[model samples]
Target: MNKTDRLLAIVLELQRKEVVRAEDLATRFETSVRTIYRDIQALSEAGVPIIGAPGTGYSLMEGYFLPPISFTVQEAVSLLMGTDFIEQRFDDDYRVRAQAARGKIEVILPESVRNETSRVRKAIRLLISDKQVTPSKEKEYLEKIRRAILDERKISFHYVKKLADFDGNRHSVRTVSPYGLVLVQGSWMLVARCELRQDIRHFRLSRMTEFIALEERFERPAHFNLREYTPSDDRHLRVRLRFNQDIADKVKESNNHYIEDMEEHQDGLHVVLRVRQLDELLRWVLGWGADVIVLEPESFRNRIREEAQKMLKRY
Candidate 1:
């Protein structure tokens, strides 16, 4: 084992009992007694309480304890909840790493702390929206995408897009130079350069049926900024809407980037948003049901009206 691992093992061994002789440690580690002495001295220098006597050998000082690497009940609950949330939402090595991290934290914690963590977690559970359904293959696709992005390699993937009125359709395989994966609204998205489109496009991970990493790699542009890329012509689109007071109060709870202004009115509230896409704005407005109304931009208002009419006909 490496020096750090050996040192940690020694500490854990000492915690179980007191006074471990240098000879025993050396024998266990297959190292010389001199090396064991050196390791102990190093630990002591690093503020470990290694007390030694001429004959009694080495021991951690009585009542000398390592700083509690403990988390508060709330902190533990948050960590567990966040880890579980990510596991459902994203696919990457980070998900497995998070599980391992949680295991390690729980293993190292004292019994009382573990019990408290468990109690808090059981008492307060995460509540995700029912509409948020993560695909089973999402993690696998994400892993391949992340590998390609990190290695600056091109990737080929078969994508399926669902249409509003038609059956889901699949496209013939295409290659792209993947730039990055974005997590937006609890869904994973990949932003990449589509060879066919000759431009960057966002692909929802759930719709990516298959992904294959290519041997070919490319250098990302030095000036490429993912944050600067937006679907709208102006990168930012201002919108105005009217909502009932009840819905207005609910909107106030959200901190989405698009929301810019909110004012109370006799009937409800007027909301102004600086958004990136009309589709996104429409989705938010529709989510509030009939409690919201589009006030400006005849084009968007007409679009919403048409979509509502379509939904009405369906019903």
Candidate 2:
């Protein structure tokens, strides 16, 4: 791109990140470090609140805010759809705020843009509102946990594991330094440094029976990065399975992380998977019902048999 565009891009990049190295900027812009430096200097001269520190990288001046930027019809529609999807997914306070924000954006849009947005919205619809699947208390508890995370405070919660204890409950109290919240496979998980585990632990939001934000504050490690955190690094469980012809195409379409390989056959399709846990795979196989069958891993077959027996007993 041209010099003016590069300078604006640099400003936006710095705004998004806490620190950005000159070398990284050079690589991103496909230019020399000298050129990146010159661009930074140009932005600084133009009264952009850019901060540069030795050894560390560049940042926007703390507390400096960017002026509102205009969005095209498509961009506005996408943003509105995003807000709508979030509303459909959760019944949190975020929904109200997002709706308010969308209204404000709609009110401020140019007449033509507003007309386009109205037309565009009429063509798109998001009907899925499955808030009942999530606990009503979850949104309130989510707010409490979010506040704790932002303030670098600890959180205390009573969690009930899916697998139960003698009394059919895997309930326990835990204290953790709030680190990150991750959404995976329709579940909200809190990844934290657990005092209970004496290590990083993942807690499902649904399992948390009670939660409290603690007054005790803690220092977040300078090197701590939520983006690098994976809830489970163990992908050791390997198994082979087969799907009947009825679901051969469906199984292929619902591409899962565990899928390692596949072989097509006249009657069915054989597949291999590398997964973290057997129960995780078992639940997925169960979802497919008669359309799927475990081809290998005798242990998996046994578990399926046991679960099937239990399910039949219930019926």
Candidate 3:
């Protein structure tokens, strides 16, 4: 193991047991007694609660504690990588808070540990694009929503819904009991209890304008399950498509829903998917452009052809 790993292991070992002999640690870490002594001194200088006596080895000071800094190596790497990714993708105050939290972790880390962390952080990256115009009001609303969610308090928010086919016709001014927030398909959604519908609903956060936390508190339902709220009605008829080699590779990389089978074709590729709804599936299939061809379900093919004809006539 490297120096940082050895040091982390030493601290964890000492925390688990009341005392660990220097000779035992040296043997476990495959180092000499002198090296172990130096490591202990390093830990002490780093403000670790390490106490020792001559020949009695070392022990963590009783009741002297460090703030909980527990994380698996993979978990730590993921957090560091995710924070860096968000820092570039989001241009909001939340992104600044995330970066600050990452900085705090690095500041408290031992020099050796910090160096290892930096190496990992430098290796991961995310693609950047045009800057998104994040609304300042929405950012403030998110801050309040986050605090209410953490504290398990009721929050009242005015939600607005824009009509799809009608211009200047929209629905606004509704209140909800906020449950949780999630990011799905590159969009932020607030899952909550709709007062009018009396059912759980997911509201896109960007669409919500005004929000307020209520003075009343509500207990989270004991049977509330977040995973159960996602859209998973998969009983609709199936559809098949054939895509070119390049498009097939992209689909494989995404690893998303409704991929039943794939087979190589002389010209391109063949793929099948079982979809529950034709409208949503049509949108997704058309998104692939000419790279994909409809192969089955004549009803869906007819719908696509009709839509294409309508668009051509409009043009």
Candidate 4:
């Protein structure tokens, strides 16, 4: 980056953090320590309130901040689009905040840039299907869970699993320490320490009902991080399938998440997928009809045979 841009970025970085060491700044900007020293000197000469010490890092003076900066048309659009997404996907509180933020941004933009942003935004749309949109109850659950996580409290809810137990009971009550919330494929999932299971587990928000935040608080693990957590892989089953050549391209376009490996053959494509249960892939495989073949796991073949025979009887 140019020196002028780098200077501005350094100031912004200072505003973002309480302190930044010279070495850290050098690594972030991919420049030499000598260059950073020179840049710091230049910023100091330019009347910026930068304080540096031998061991301590650099920091700006208290209450010092950059004046309002101009945003390019593209940058304005990106911010506006972010607000739009937040409005559509977040809770009512955030939706109101996003609308206010959008108005503030639009009011400050240059008229020409604002007009161009509006024109460009008309061509780009964020389409959310009904199934993907956050439901009313889910939004309430999200807000409560968010508060619970922030307060380091436990939450209780009744969850319905995808399958029933031997007694045909699918509903169960759970009390968990809220860890974090994750959005996967437009659905909200809660990652938490399940007290009943005595382990961390993921629960879909949609399947949760009668939710309440408990008054009791719990201490979260210092080393636990939701971003780096990976579930155990022992339960996952590997199933291989062959797709007919004609629909191979379409299969690639589907971008199914569980697909681990794929290779092209003259007759078709060999695709291997990992899923928690064989039933998880049953409907997806059936969607391809005769064009897709289950290439491995004779049990899956028998399962398919039984399903196909059931379909034949119905026909």
Ranking of predictions according to TM-score: 4, 2, 3, 1
Best by lDDT: 4
- Whole-model lDDT, model 3: 0.75
- Collision count of model 3: 1
- When sorted by lDDT, best at the front, the candidate numbers are 4, 2, 1, 3
Q: After TM-score superposition, what is the CA distance of residue 73 in candidate 2 from its true location, in Å? A: 2.0
Candidate 4's residue-wise lDDT over 117-221, tens digit each? 999999999888897899999999998999999999999999998767569888999999999999987889999999999999899999999998899999999
C-alpha RMSD of candidate 2: 3.6
Question: Candidate 3 residues 228-298, lDDT tens each?
Answer: 75654645678888888877788776555677777888978787787656765777777787787788889
- Relative to the true structure, candidate 4 reaches a TM of 0.90
Q: Residue pairs in steric clash, candidate 2? A: none
lDDT tens per residue, model 1, 101-211: 788778877788789999878887677776676666877888888888889999988876543212433465668999888888778889888897788878888887667
Return the TM-score for candidate 3, rounded to 2 decimals: 0.61
